[model samples]
Target: PSTSLLVDSMVKKGLFDRKENPRDRRSLCIRLSEEGESRFQLLYNGMKKRLDSLFGILSDQDQEDFCRIVDTLYTHVYTK
Candidate 1:
C-alpha cells in the first residue's frame, strides 16, 4: 500500500504514468513518462561517459583488478 502511494505520487510528479492493469481492474501499472525516460537516458549516458573516461585512464589489467575488488566489496557489504 505504501508502494502504491509512492507510485501515485511519482505519477503526479510527471515522472511516470498510472495506468489501469489489463488483467486486474483494481490494479494499476506504473510506467515512466516520456520526460522521465529522457531524463533517465541523459543520466545513463552521463554516467557511462564518465565511467568510460575513468576506465580509459587505467591499464586493462588495472581495470580488471579494480572490477574484481569492487565486486568483492559489493558482495562483502551486501551479504552482511
Candidate 2:
C-alpha cells in the first residue's frame, strides 16, 4: 500500500493528526494523536512485560550478552 493510503487510514481512525507543515506549507507534518499515544503506550508496556518475563530466566551474563548482541545488530543495521 502507498504511504498516503496508510496515513489516510490512520487519520480516519483518529490515530494520527495530519497537518500542513509550518515551515513548508507544501509538506505535511504527521503526528500521533492522543489516542494513538495511549495505544502505543499500552502496546509498548505489554511487549516490554513479555520480554522481561522471557528474559528473566536468563543469567545476568547471558542477558548482558544478549543486549550487546542486540546493540551490535542495531548499530550495523541502522548505520548502513
Note the Cα lDDT for every prediction shown.
0.91, 0.97
Candidate 1 ranges with C-alpha deviation above 4 Å: none
Clashing pairs in 2: none
Task: Show model 2 residue runs off by greater than 4 Å.
Answer: 72-80
Instruction: Report residue 27 deviation for candidate 2 (angstroms).
Output: 0.6
Query: For residues 1-80, what per-residue lDDT tens digits would candidate 2 score against the true structure?
Result: 59999999999999999999989989999999999999999999999999999999999999999999999999999998
Q: Write the per-residue lDDT of candidate 1 for residues 1-80, one digit (tens) a residue.
A: 89878877888889998788999998778889998898999999999999999899999999999999999999999998
Best by lDDT: 2
Worst 10 residues of 2 by lDDT: 18-27
Tell me the TM-score of model 2. 0.84
